[model samples]
Target: MKKVALIASVAMVFSLSLNAWTLGKLGDFKFEKVNDNVYVMHGPVMMPNKENGGFMNNPALIESKNGLIVIDPGGNYNVGKNVLAEVEKVSKKPVIAIFNTHKHGDHWFANKNFQEKYPNVKIYALAYMIEQAKDNAAETWYGILGSLTGNLEGTKPFAFPNSSVDHKETVVVDGQTFIMRHPAAGHTDTDILIEHVNSKTLFLGDNLMKNRFGAFDESSSIFGNIQILENVIAKKDGYKDYKLYVPGHGPSGKLHETLDPFLNYMKIIIAGAQKAYKNGMESYEIKEEVYNNLKDYHKWDDIEGQMGKHLMKAYSEVEMRDF
Candidate 1:
């Protein structure tokens, strides 16, 4: 009898411990304080799927005298709500402005949750991004995420950006100045480059990544990305001292540390693809060759999973070019 009772007690304790751990892990919101009033939640490096609860993207919060401004809030409704829960832990200011860095679903779908709570907050994005999210983009992803999470609770309908900015503009909110620049075709057709003037922090959205690169965006323009990257480099030169860069993924870094390596990687992709095409290689042959050759760039980040996909896309992109 005592042996059975001991086993039962152990089982009960273990069950309670597991439940506590699950709740604490899910409810926790980890954020990094980059500069004064600038807090960034560098989400899990894993992609948004069943395991991570559709959490990806470096969602940031900027507390200004006017209110809290959230950048790339996240990819799902719960993702944004959890961020808000964290915001409450730090500042009591209401979120006044929400900005979507680019058109990628990872950066914008969470707007629904924010809008439901703060309907008055001005959500900003490129006109195209806003329109798509309100229409097909978010709807398509919502279904995928639903299937992935089994229609997980807190996943809400898609929301639209209330304010669409077509031109470069500056807004002073709560005495803090923010400059928005359009990096057309850089990472995507709908990309925004935001300069948090007060903190000298540049939010590059998906335009720049650090430590490693994510999937190659087939929807974006390689040449256009190069042009915008060059422009961004020049802009970096104008800065008096080192400035912090909040990339869409990975860690925040300085321009030289983050942007320069990415520029080199982009150039290499173009050059490698063109060279493979000139070799009279068929598409299949080019993909195999490029996949193996690009493994050298693992120094930049793990390209094992993406190299095969990127090679196929790069080959087609270069094949279409006039050269």
Candidate 2:
């Protein structure tokens, strides 16, 4: 009886230690390889809240010759630790690089953990994003996620990306090549679409969302978002053929299902906004009519709540272009 009790205690301790870094509410998630040497862990579609532990971004991993590369680790420190743990399951090699898609806290706050784990790892983001992080972006995100999750206690704004990348720059690390594309401001002025040249996969950050309505913040441009999507689809600006598309907040799939839906949504919003603006209709008055047309997006996360805000931004873009 004594021996059995001791063994049971040891097993319990092992389990507790194993999960010491576990923080997310979404249970049992692992990076699923979507393409050769490319893996993505699609996070919950819902907005960050106390239940989800501030994890609502699709963190990805890329296996290279010497080490792995991470994209958008997660929203906070605990979540970053969990992301690192998942990376270890696939490769014991140190993370050689990280690419933050934009300046959103949900996408890059976890950068803190990666830097602590791999001191030499180089984190990359758009120059604009790096600038924002250096400014008040980090502190602003810390407070935002802290309030949203209520559990982001240990996370801080300490580890902003150390390196800056630019549009159309080819970055080579660990025998892998990534082409950064930022034809225009989309999700935010800081947005960058990372194309893994080897795996033929494109990581469309918050610029493209699947089954979710992303925000059009002050820095965001709906017209610009549409132009980026159309350019990629038409293979313009060297965005040639790709096998897979990974969105910022949803599943990875081919262009038809992964990229087109959101593109179509933005198009509908802009067209409606243009027509409404010409008629001199108020944003609130036009959103309901537009919402009725967005029947297909009715099931998308937060569409109803985000509809008014999206329309206002769309109207502004139309107003800017016409007058």
lDDT top scorer:
2
TM-score of each: 0.82, 0.92
Local error of candidate 2 at residue 51 (angstroms): 0.7
lDDT of 1 by residue, 1-323 (tens): 99999999999767644543122254434666888889998876545566667775789999988689889888777666776676665678788988887766667778877788888989888788777667676677677667765534665546778898764678777887787777557777778788889998888887877656666565677767777667777764232233688888877877787777667777776777788788877556666555565554666545766656655666778888855
Clashing pairs in 1: 66-174
Ten-residue segment with the worst summed lDDT in candidate 1?
A: 19-28
User: Candidate 2, residues 3-106: lDDT per residue as tens digits?
Assistant: 99999999977875676444445566778888999999888888788878888889999999889999999998888888888788778988999999988889
The TM-score that candidate 2 achieves is 0.92
Error of 2 at 302 (Å): 0.7
List the pairs of residues colliding in candidate 2: none
Off by over 4 Å in 1: 1-29, 147-152, 216-218, 236-242, 295-302
Candidate 2 residue-wise lDDT at 210: 88
Which residue window of length 10 is worst by lDDT in model 2?
A: 19-28
